[model samples]
Target: MRDEALPTVTAICRALIEQIDSGLLPAAGKLPAERRLSELFDTTRITLREALTQLEAQGLIYREERRGWFVSPPRLLYNPLVRSHFHEMVAGQNRVPATEVISARQVPASPAICAHLELPALSSVYQIRRARRVDGRLVLYVEHYLNPAYFPGILDCDLRQSLTDLYASRYDIRYGRVRFDMVPTALHGEAAAALRVAEGSPALRITRINRDQHGRIIDCDLEFWRHDAIHVSVEVPD
Candidate 1:
């Protein structure tokens, strides 16, 4: 007897699962509209819906009445989560991650950033503007201010690489913990252009504070992620 082949709906679901695992579908992300997917897969509406229903039942996908389907966020089963380094997170998933250092210069830390980083008045800090991309799609536009006292001439280093690793290996300083506050807000003016979204579009603004082993704040970064492209997850322990 020959081994049985998987059902058509199962095969469709498997294809989508492969895309998600490969980063082509993104994590905790919205799926294409049904019409688009039907065309892409050259399948009828009924078959597509059946495949989607099966995927949803398996907890691999979810559907919002008005928003359609989206990939479920990665399960955070255990560990309250220490510090999450963006560089490491992307690398672990085997994604093509790259960064562009838009600008780096010495500037007085803004009052807001200074307050977040807990710096002295009029302190000279190194500011870096960067855009992070996964597979050539812009994912995050970040503005980071670092204490010059700790990482001198950090602006000269290749920021496209991992800054966290650089700080650890080159300066013997590593981020011990971090705090994040995220909100959904409308983008406008320059921020809209950098993120390639229309003005007043919803965006996720994340303010992150990184602390060193001594519990001293090292860098305060503001990250803007296009709301349409990201899916935020909060775990509810059962």
Candidate 2:
């Protein structure tokens, strides 16, 4: 029985691969219902699920809670060294991009935030939480902390727009230098919930500090990205 089932699983996996390669299952396209797929493959539900799991492990497919499986979209190319904003980068790749502002408010800076921003303890900072999507798929959740002293009326502006542009237009604060630190981390709490991924799922955490012309920190950003959704690339000049 085991031998027979193994061959069936292998066949199902190969067939699905062929479908994906042929564009029948286009990137980001949802797979058929499990019952229908099982019938088409002439296999039991358990066997069909096993086959799907194999494809997911290969990065050809992914599942969302209660949303069924979908063909994994091509990973977004990201260059941290580039000064372009998220919207510009994604549009350059011909993928639709959007930013949703989750929350924005002024908060007293915590010790860690204060240290990062080089501000006095208990200084007030604007905390803005946002989620970014590429091709309608949520890819990143970010929290931005800005020292309110630099822009007194910042909270009155639209927070959903490109912050880089906002800084330049509203406050004449252009990006001068940036520092980035990246680490592999598990999605948790607000980050996980905002990205719609399960807690403890693998994610990439990026911490960024943007400075202005005089080297004053403009904002500190914490970005959580789906590990499978982005490909980081950097060019080094010799």
Clashes of each: 0, 0
TM-scores for candidates 1 onward, in order: 0.63, 0.86
Worst 10 residues of 2 by lDDT: 56-65
Report every candidate's CA lDDT: 0.73, 0.89
Candidate 1 per-residue lDDT, tens place, 75-146, comes to 322112534466666666666667888888999877887788888777778888888866555657888888
Model 1 scores worst on lDDT over the 10 consecutive residues at 75-84
* Candidate 2 residue lDDT tens string, 87-189: 9999999999999999999998989889889999669899999999999988899999999888788878898899999999988898889999999998888
TM-score: which candidate is best? 2
